[model samples]
Target: MTATRLASVVLVLLTLCSTAVPDVARAETWEAVISATSPDGLGTATVHYQHLAAGDSPTAEEINDHIDAEANRAVTQAMWDGSTRRPWTFDASGRLTTWAITVSEVFTGVYNTAEPHMPMNRLGSVVCDTRSGIIISWDNLFSDKTAGLTRLGEQLETQVAAVASPTELRTWRRSGQFAPVDVNFKYWIPTREGVALQIPEVQFGRGLKVVIVPWSAISDLIAPEFLPITG
Candidate 1:
């Protein structure tokens, strides 16, 4: 072969080889069972999670690490020092079949003759069906003392749709008897690390009345531990 033709052939072969080779192989998904121990050492809770994509299962250890990272980011940004405990079980389809006993704490300031500060304890549970990517049930227990106060409040179910990489629109409503009051909340997910959740833009009631609030106004009330996951 001519030298010029041989050089062209070698260049073409190199280009094809480079194109065929991937820089990084895709990671396989695995199901993960995470058990969180409470900071007080009083209890532990477990949760099962898997990647949303099909044929992806992450190990329990990986899931636990991801949960810890997100939870830490959430709490730190909200300026709260709290932890959670839970145990979760997953089915073969990568759905969470059971979850139990997740507790959190916060500092509360009570006004009497003077400002008295106290630590408040709160407990909650998040149950979900991992296969369907649906949360089945949840409950919250609060330590506030009042006459005839109902510890359990409204049960809420949310359906979320990602409109963009950084924006998600959600339809949420209270389950059971409170179903009549449906609302829409829009979340702007952070594109960078260390930023917390923004104040959700709420369209309240069936009539869809829009209300906007500052992120700081509800930052303390929002759960900092859970952030949106992109599939």
Candidate 2:
């Protein structure tokens, strides 16, 4: 072959090689295990959890370990306390994307009662990066933590106000749970529709409440890498 023709062939080979390479971002593969603890008088605690089933990456191993530990904790907690039969329930569901996995947990009835003589509900979540196997915090989803959280607080107020009565709104604002603080906003996970934010208490008699920050509202606030875009 002439020099120019040989160069052209090499270019084509390189292009093919590049395209054939797998995307490192989606390297991890996992399976969700829907399980429950052995039933006792207390009742069964259930979970939909993810385990790294096919990947050999170190990050996958770490993520698997976290899943096991979390599942164990949930199962143990759900076991009968041997006395209290409040007909309460503890359950978890897992959501997955190529880059992240989130486990959203809920507790209902007596077990999830509010603090300080108040009656509220419980909400929790665990979000982990599939690539690095890192358990990410609510703040970690944002490119600018302060700005994102501020906007999140604003969204919370807007959504909650729409549904809350004047009295309920006043009480929630007093409790500080409606604030933008990290601890107050622990129960959140990204879903296909939007990012789900859970409110532990907004009213005395009312149970837990959830509000979604739509992708349209937060597409710029969250880091693109952590978007949890479903297939």
lDDT of all the models against the reference? 0.23, 0.54
Q: List the residue pairs that clash in candidate 2.
A: 114-120
Poorly placed runs, candidate 1 (over 4 Å): 1-27, 51-68, 71-231
lDDT value, residue 151 of candidate 2:
78
Candidate 1, residues 1-231: lDDT per residue as tens digits?
Answer: 334322221100001111221111122233434333333443333333332122233332333343333333322222222222322111111222122211111111111111122122211122222333333211111122121011111111221222212222222322222132111111112112211212221232221121223233323333323312111
CA RMSD, predictions in order? 23.1, 16.0
Q: Which stretches of candidate 2 lie over 4 Å from their true place?
A: 1-50, 75-122, 201-205, 224-231
lDDT of 2 by residue, 40-76 (tens): 3343455554444434467655765765565555445
Give Cα distance to truth, residue 221, candidate 1, Å.
29
